[model samples]
Target: MKAHRLLTVAVLVAATACGISPTDVQDRGNAPTTRIPPPSKTIYLLKDGRLVLEPADVDNDTVGSLLGALFDASTKPLGERDTALRGFTYIGIKDSLNPIQRDEVQLPRTSTLTVYIRGEGTLTDLGKAQIVCTAQQDAAFEQVRIVRENEDRPSRTEGRYTCGELK
Candidate 1:
């Protein structure tokens, strides 16, 4: 019993001797923040003449991956909904000066994403809406500019558009 009391006293002294002091909680300002990723991938397709957001089974939410999925005929939702992306072929994401030569392209955290495409036919406003809305599904990309490149003519800007503007 004496030894137990002595050990308890020694523990108490050692704990108190440490530099740490009991104090009230400090107000250290706001906590750090983080961007939460979306629960599922989404792509824009046309329901009748209007744009509609549809859940996609795409592997990643990258601009290229989403565009690729948007263009893929097999993945198109059945019934009235159809893809306007068929009017143009998805080339790649336009970098600072040139298009990225890859199958998948991930945009920077927050920036405008420019996508290069070769229009198989005359790209209508609906086509532009499809491309713009589909690309903008990734929150990192605030706006999308569709650049149409033709073999016989110089590339032309279809106009920068946001999902809200098109849809």
Candidate 2:
């Protein structure tokens, strides 16, 4: 009986030293009292005829990975159709018309990033517009120049563009 009383006093002393009351210890058995919101990142998407800013709860903030997700064909925006708006592709090789299927292409950290498109196809002008605007959103790329794979020079359709003009 004496040892039990001493143990209780020791526990009370330890709790007081830790700045936690015995009542607080008991209350801990209750459900969690605080909830922290998950971290999120802001990314742009094309909807209708404009780029829309949306917050996504992504794991990390790697620019390449974020670009990949933004370009992913399966990612659907809220209140939108299941299909992706930007289906444009490019062929980096000179004179080759092969289409690069992925949504994103990461260029070396440069002031101007050149995006080469397949010279001819059903690729719409809207897709090209989205590509230019989306790439320029990155801080590393201040200007985006779209060109054809086989063309030596940038055509009127293929030239330097800024996000401001498109978005």
Candidate 3:
């Protein structure tokens, strides 16, 4: 009985001697939650005459959809940055046949992404950079071709460009 009593006292003293003070439960607000982010694509915009890569929210990841988002004014540039793709409209992809003559032209492979646009005058180098970089965001596409559509026959090829060459 003496040994049992001494053991009980020792346990009590040891429990209280440990410098930990008991406190009430803490209410740290609600539990943490996790959510998946919306879909987004990388696009190139211009800042002070230089190319700046930016993320843009989009409903689809298609080249046309991505370019459409790039051209959208609502997708404002961050800070004092600007977009070279402004004032340019994206046209549908070129088909295998020439629209005028109905002659079969070489179809573009998956590695080549073509961007057709209808705009007045020529596009500046920065503007070309924006289109080329945005369209070639996927590594699957090795090159990007910009074709200018006009009322006349034989559309002008702006030139085939690679993101590496432009950047």
Candidate 4:
């Protein structure tokens, strides 16, 4: 009887992970009795000539494993936690990169890259836009700045991060 119960639980976990809904599970107790949401927008990643492809946000529970989820383990798609934490991004690399040039794969000393974003979004009263930045970098670091708008004391903040290339 104990072995049977363990098997049942294992099967339940596997079914859920495979995108099966609780309602779809038969021979189970209460059909799981839980719900999770999938992601909205799809994204593509390219770094160091490597391509990384990622599906949309995916179920809220799995958000932590998504490319954007690398920013936060407990973050929802575009949800604001500004009063709590600063966010970062994960770069996408879909496929392996091959070398096909006269140069023998020599890396540069210093290269600056600028990404362009063209889309509509919501703004906070403090005037900061929430965006998913997916890029590759050698190390992770954040800068803080305090800006006073309207004679109010400037508040400390995490600097904007760019994640798309190796430094």
Candidate 5:
């Protein structure tokens, strides 16, 4: 169980650090083979083994160690819910403008699942983002970007499709 937790952490680290995987150049379902609508919420993809948060790409906030670790597992099967938090972690805040965020709970072998939760309903300078997750495999990522929804905060995005934008 501890190892599983550790691996979960590893995935979170990988997500925030380098996105999710190498093949996901664009967001999932945005494939050339299968055409999908452009996502209103710009989420970071783990393509080519890297982390990316769009419409913008950068990490300028101070990530709390405990929060980072908590975020690492929040999308999985751990961490707090819509409570309230701040910092630089894959987990961001949700507000009235952008009240939704999603995270992927990676399950070995099986398909990935997405968890969707509402954010704090407001954006403060502290990066008090809303959006939490539940471990649900094979489910589609949410339809909210952590920041794009609110131009004020661009890094904020969600969806199980997100590897880890907390970067």
Candidate 6:
């Protein structure tokens, strides 16, 4: 009887150790899966006329997504004193636009990034510089450009300028 009792206790312990608990044995098909998105891209934001690179872990690698990360207000910069992009909305993705008469689109194109703004407002020169600098950080894009929808054109092109060059 003692040997039998010891064997039962050992079996129970081994089962529990093997993750055979009754609760854990229930079907887990509906259980929520916790997945963490890995950081795969770098972006630049503006603060005091200087560009700061920030790491972003996003599900999508589109131009608009990168812009969204750069403009996110909650992101903390490397330096406590650094600030993020002031005014910009991630509209969507697009390939073509009219320079004279533009409309809002998000995650537009790898070569050309379109921004959606609210009301009659637009991104300042410094803001555009921030966008350009941030977009260029991605290796996929060779000459990333910024186009503000229903807003004025940026003062400089992407390849020709840097965030530090902004004033």
Q: What is the lDDT of residue 108 in candidate 6?
A: 43
Off by over 4 Å in 5: 1-33, 43-85, 91-129, 132-139, 142-167
Give the per-residue lDDT of model 1 (tens digit) for 48-116: 788888877688756788777777743445687886666567788953333334558744344678998
**Tens digits of lDDT, candidate 2, 64-118:** 4444454554344456522233444443312212333446864444466666554
Top of the candidates by TM-score: 1
- 5 against 6, candidate with superior lDDT: 6
TM-score of 4: 0.19
TM-score of each: 0.64, 0.43, 0.61, 0.19, 0.17, 0.44
Q: For each candidate, C-alpha RMSD in Å?
A: 11.4, 13.1, 12.5, 19.8, 25.5, 12.6
Model 4: weakest 10-residue lDDT segment is 139-148
Off by over 4 Å in 3: 1-40, 74-79, 94-110, 152-154
* Per-candidate total of colliding backbone pairs: 0, 0, 0, 8, 30, 8
Better of 1 and 4 by lDDT: 1
Per-residue error (Å), model 5, residue 58: 8.3
Off by over 4 Å in 1: 1-39, 74-77, 95-110
Ranking by lDDT: 1, 3, 6, 2, 5, 4
TM-score of candidate 1 to 2 decimals:
0.64
Summing lDDT over every window of 10 consecutive residues in candidate 6, give the lowest-scoring window. Answer: 154-163
lDDT of 5 by residue, 1-167 (tens): 99999999998887888754556446657446764533323232233333323221213222222224334433443122222333223433322222333465433333332222234455331132223221111133332234324335533334332223332
**Which is the leading candidate under lDDT?**
1
Task: Decide which is better by TM-score, 2 or 4.
Answer: 2
lDDT of 4: 0.33
Query: Which lDDT tens digits does candidate 3 get at residues 37-150?
Result: 423477788777888877776777766777777777424546777876666777865323222322566554545677898777668888888888887776666778899888
Global Cα lDDT for candidate 1: 0.76
Give the poorly placed runs of model 6, Cα more than 4 Å off.
Answer: 1-40, 74-81, 96-110, 119-122, 139-145, 150-167
